[model samples]
Target: MSEALLDIRNLELRYGAAVAVRDISLQVHPGQLVAVIGNNGAGKSSMVRGATGLVRPSGGQVIFRGEDTTRLPANKKVARGLVMVPEGRLLFPGQTVEDNLILGAYVHGGIKTPRSKATLQRVLELFPRLRERLHQQAGSMSGGEQQMLAIARGLMAEPELLVIDELSLGLAPKIVDQLIGVLADLNRTGLTILLVEQLASYALAIAHTAYVVANGRISHHGPSAELARDPEVMEAFLGRKKTAA
Candidate 1:
C-alpha cells in the first residue's frame, strides 16, 4: 500500500481557555478522498486551520510527506504541496480571476514558469466558467462561481494533498452537485483530498473513508457507505430515526 500523504496525530487547538479541537488524528493516503463531516462549530474548520498552519495547534503533530511540519508557516506548507481552499472562499475582490490564479502559483514560481502555466490551463479546463470570466473581477461572480475560483486557485499551487473546508456552504443544490462532481473527477485523477464538510451526504458519497467529528473530537469513522447508513449519523443529519437496514 502507498504511504499516507497527510497524517495528523492527536491534534489540539485552543482559543484562550476554550478548546476548539482536541486529540484529533486522521490520515489521507496517496490518491484517496477522505471526508471529515460535522455540524457547524463542531471544530471541523478549526481542525483544518490547525492542519494547514493557518492557526497553530497547542499539541500533537502534523506530518506531511514523512516530515514534521507542526511548526511550519502556512506559506512553507504550500511550498511543500500542502494547500487548502479555506471555508470562506476568500479571494482578492478587486483583482481579476486571472490575477488571483497567478497569486496562487507564487510558491511554485509564479505564473511565468512553464509548470505554473500548465497548471493554470488545467485549472481553467476544469472550470470552464472561470475561463470565460478570466478578466472579470473575482468579487463580481456568483457564490458558486467564487467557490469554484477558490478551488481552482488552490489547484494552481500543484498540491499533493488538497484540504477543502466547507465545500457546499451557501450554494444552490444544483451548483453543489456540480462541484461535488468536479471533486470526484479530481480524485479519480489521483489527487489526495481531505474534505471538511457540513453536508455529510454529499461528502460521504464521494469519499472512500470518513470521520465524524462532534464537539471537539472524532466520534465515529470508517468506510463512507457504512457511515452513511449509521443510525446516529442519519439522525444527526436528517433529524429522523433510521428505518432502513
Candidate 2:
C-alpha cells in the first residue's frame, strides 16, 4: 500500500482540566478528500488545531510525509506545504484581496517562489469572482466572497495538504454548493484535503473517507459512501430528522 500523506496516531488534547480530544487516530492519503464531521464542542476544532500545531497534542504523534511533525511550529508546518483555511474567513478587513493573498506566502521567508504567480492565477481562475474584486477590501465583499478569498489565500501557499474548517458555515445553500464544487475540483487536481465540516451530508458527498467525531472521540470511521448509507452514522452526525430518506 502507498504511504499515507498524513497520519495522526492516538492524538489527545486538553484544555485546562478537561480533555478536548482523546485517542483520535486518522490517516489521510495523497489525492484524497477526508472529512471530519462533528457537532459543536465535539473537539473537531481541537483536532485541527493540534494537527497544525496551534494547540499541542498532550500525547500521540502527527506524522507528515514520513516525518514526526508533532512538535513542529505552525509556521514550519506551513512552510512544509501544510496549510489551513481556518473556521472563520479571517481576512484582513482593511486589506485588499490581493494583499491578503500575498500574506499567505509569508511563510516562505518573504521570498517569492516562481510558482507564486501561477498559483494566484489558478486560484483566481477557481474563483473568477475574486479576480474582479482583487483591489477591493475583503471586508466589503459578501460572506460567500470572503470565504472564497479565504480558501484562495490558502491555495496561494501551494500546499501539499490543505485543511479546511467549517466550510459551509453561515452561508446560503447555493454559495455552499459553489464552494464545495470548487473544493471538489481542487481535490481532483491531486491536492490532499482534510475538510472539517458541520454538515455531514455535504461532507460525505465529496469525501473519500469520513470520521464522525462526538464527545471528543471518533464515533464512526469508514468509507464516506458507506457512512452516508448507515442509519446509525447518519443519525449520529446528520441528526435523525435530516437523515430520513
Candidate 3:
C-alpha cells in the first residue's frame, strides 16, 4: 500500500474550556480522497482547522509525511504543501482573480519559478471560467465562481495534501456537481484530499474513505461505499433512511 500522506491520532481541540474536537483519529493515504461528513457544529471544521495548524490541538498529534507537526504554525504547514481552502470561500474580495491566485504561491516567496506558472496554467485549465475573469475583482463573482476561485487559488500552492471545507455551500446543485467533478479529477491525479462536507451523497460519490463525526468525535470510519450503506452513518449525517435508488 502507498504510505499515508497524513495522519491524525487522538486529536483534540478546545475553545477556552469547551472542547470543539475530541480524540479524533484518521489517516489519508497518498492520492486518496477522504471525506468527513457531519452536520453543522459537529466539529468537522474544528478538525480541519486543527490539522492545518489553525487551531492548536489541546492534545494528540498531527503527523504529516511521517513527521510530527502538532505544533507547527499554519504558514509552515503551507510551505510543507498542506493547504486549506477554508469555509465561506475566503478570498481577497477587492483583489483581481490573478492577484488572489498569485497570493496562493506566496509560500514560495516571489521566486517566479516555472513551477508556479505551470501550476497557474493548470488551474486555469481545470477552471476555464477563471481564465476569462483573471482581471475581474473576486468580490464581483457569483458565489459559485468565488468558491471556484478559492479552490483554484489553493491549487496554485501545489499541495500534497489539500483540505477543503464545504464545497457545496450556498450554490445550485449543478454548480456543486461541477466543482466536485474538478476535485475528483484532482484526486485521481494523485493529490490527497481531505474534504469536509455536509452533502453526504455527493461527497461519498467521489471519496475513497469516509468518516462521520458527531458531538465532537469521530463516530464512524470506513470505505466510502460501506459507510454509505451503513445505517449508523446515514442516521448520524443524513438523519433519515437512505431511500433505495
Candidate 4:
C-alpha cells in the first residue's frame, strides 16, 4: 500500500480526568474508505477529535501527510488538507447555504482565487440540491438536505482526506443510504475517507477496511467483508441477524 495519508499512533484522549481514547492507532491510506464503528460513548468521536486536532490528545501522535500535527488546531489541519465534517451538521443557522460553503473555503481565503472558484463549482456540481438552495438559509433545510450541505461545504476545502464523524446521526435510513452511496462514489474517485459511523452494517457495506470500537478501544480490525461476517462482531453489535423461519 502507498504511504498513509493520515496516521494516528497510540492516540489517547481525555476529558479532564476521564480518558476517552486509549492507545488507539489507525490509518487511512489514499483512496481507501476506512470505517470506525462503535456504540455510543465508545470513544469513536473522541479519537476523531484527537486525530483531527479539534481536541488535543493526552498522549501519542497524529501524523498527517508525513508531518507531526498532534497539537495543531483544527483550522491548521484544514489548511493542511485534513478536513472533518463534524458529527452534527454544524452549519451557520442564519447564513445562506452559499455562505456556509464560503466558510468551508476560509482556509483558502474564501473562494476568492480561481482555484477556489473551481472547487466551489465542483462542489455545487456534486450536490445540485445545494446549488438550487444556494440562496436558502442553511438552518431552514430538511435534515438530509442539511447533511448534503455539510458534505458539500467540506468538499469546498478540497481535502486530500475527508474524515466524517457520525454520518448516520439523526438521519433516516433512506437518507443514510443515499449519503452512503455518495461516499462510496467519492472513494472510487480517489478521495480518502475515514468514516466514523455507529451503524456498522451501513459503514461496512461501503468501507474497504473497518475497525470495531468497544469500551473506548478497538475490539476488532479487518477487511469489511470478513468483519461483516464475523459472528462475534455481528452478535456483539448488529444483534444477531434474523433468518427466515
Higher-TM-score candidate among 1 and 2?
1
Residue pairs with clashing backbones, model 4: none
Tens-digit lDDT track for model 4 on 37-153? Answer: 988889999999999898999999999999999999999999999999999979998999999999999999888999999999988888889999999999999989999988988
Q: Flag the better candidate by TM-score, 1 or 3.
A: 1
Q: For model 2, how many clashes?
A: 0
State the lDDT of candidate 2 residue by residue for 64-153, as single tens digits: 988999999888899888899999978898999999989976775432676787778888888899999999999999999999999988
- Looking at model 2, residue 43 earns an lDDT score of 91
TM-score versus the correct structure, for each prediction: 0.96, 0.95, 0.96, 0.96
For this target, which candidate reaches the highest lDDT against the unseen true structure? 1
The models' CA-based lDDT, in order, is 0.91, 0.88, 0.90, 0.90
* CA lDDT for candidate 2: 0.88
Model 1 lDDT per residue over 1-245, tens place: 67778999999999988999988999989999999998888899999989899999999999999999999999999999999999999899899999999999999889998999999999999999999999999999999999999999999999999999988888987898899999999999989899888888889889999999998899999999999888788678742224546
Off by over 4 Å in 4: 238-245
Q: Candidate 4: deviation at residue 82, Å?
A: 0.6
**Where's the lowest-lDDT run of ten residues in candidate 3?**
236-245
lDDT of 3 at 56: 93
Q: List the residue pairs that clash in candidate 3.
A: none
Alpha-carbon deviation at 232 in model 2, angstroms: 1.1
Error of 1 at 60 (Å): 0.6
